[model samples]
Target: MNNNTPNNNLTIESLWQFSLQYYSMREIKEACLNLQNHFHGNVNLLLALKWLDEHRLTFPSSQWPQVIQSLGRTEALLLHFRELRRKSKQHLPESLYRDSLQFELQLERQQQADIIDIIHRIELSKVEAPHLVDDYCHQLGAEHLAVIFNKQRL
Candidate 1:
């Protein structure tokens, strides 16, 4: 949906816009890039976790694997875009490389939207407030996943 469209309540588009805005913050961008490069973190999932944490909602422990499974091909899509972008930088003219960079970014945005669609399908299981972020990481299969969200110190 166009982000300009009005909604009575928060929707995936809002969350996606929040992700775009929040992830653009210098600190968050650096941290997210570190997580992506060093720890195989999915930035989209991290943004959704932040949104869910803010709203005081979480998936049940039983459903963590479901969340990971629902990520579908986001990782693969990112890999594809990254490869294309990298190759374009090496082989294409500066103008084409710049255009490829923009297209790659758009692909990344669409990938985020796809992940949000999966997240919207989940049934909210409310939980204790402060623990939601950690809970999300644990569900992702490591206590350290929370480090990316900064719910715990490394």
Candidate 2:
């Protein structure tokens, strides 16, 4: 997880880039959105977990309190807009649905940045990707963790 590690090329910009590339994969966007809709799983956190797994970084569950605290404002804003988008999707015109969803997408990006900032501020343990994935799924309370973790096309 150290910057000096061979795979330690992580920066905020790179993290965001990785998120876009990863989410663009077939079915990944669907899985992430499903997790977000059903489990209250933050897509940003899920993306961060993927990045951390790539970089061999492990974050314990104990660190989540601080991470959650750090994300308070951004998460709240995202949630508010996401709910609006959901409602608009159900009741509003199709044209308005796109706008609302776009706004929520921007908020999700902002929350991703907030998440990467928190990850940068915290200490990371060096562990195998399997261990990191297990830790991340456990912390997220992902009942269907295998589907998301193993659904990668690679």
Candidate 3:
């Protein structure tokens, strides 16, 4: 039902306008909630609370945190989700790459499954020695996967 009646304090138009005006998604939702409470009988605002989050939201890098938090939505939908998308590859699984890269780069024992996987993908015959690892790195550079071998000196 619509709440464009004379006494209604909130409207769909205002909600959209509020988002444009504020850097914080939380602030926008807070403002909407306050107006909803002030009027107490507006079904339009109530309906909005259900669907405002289903849509995708991206923001300027400067406003991302506020845009994310103020929107009163899950980070998976509007925030960190982009990182998930960026790390995805058509030929490789995202979770496997992130987990393997993290484990492979960590400072620990000389062995890890991640290291083995990296070696296997690059081919042992192509790289012949420890010093040649840098050459292997150059080859892997094309894939933007060189960050995996940092091995963290510290």
Among all windows of 10 consecutive residues in model 2, the one with the lowest summed lDDT is: 1-10
Better of 1 and 2 by TM-score: 2
Residue-level lDDT of model 1, residues 1-154, one tens digit each, is 2333222344667777777787777777877776567666677777777776766566666666767775676668777778778866777899988887787677676766775665566666554664655665564455664665664221
By lDDT rank, best first, the candidates go 2, 1, 3
lDDT agreement of model 1 with the native = 0.66
Q: What is the Cα root-mean-square deviation between model 2 and the actual structure?
A: 3.0
When sorted by TM-score, best at the front, the candidate numbers are 2, 1, 3
- Tens digits of lDDT, candidate 3, 94-140: 78767655543231112122222222222121112222212223432
Give per-residue lDDT, candidate 2, residue 64. Answer: 72
Clashes of 1: 0
Tell me how far the alpha carbon of residue 148 in candidate 1 is from the true structure, in angstroms, after superposition.
6.6
Instruction: Kindly give the number of clashing pairs for every candidate.
Output: 0, 0, 4
Best by lDDT: 2
* Number of the top TM-score candidate: 2
Query: Over all chains combined, what TM-score does candidate 2 have?
Result: 0.77
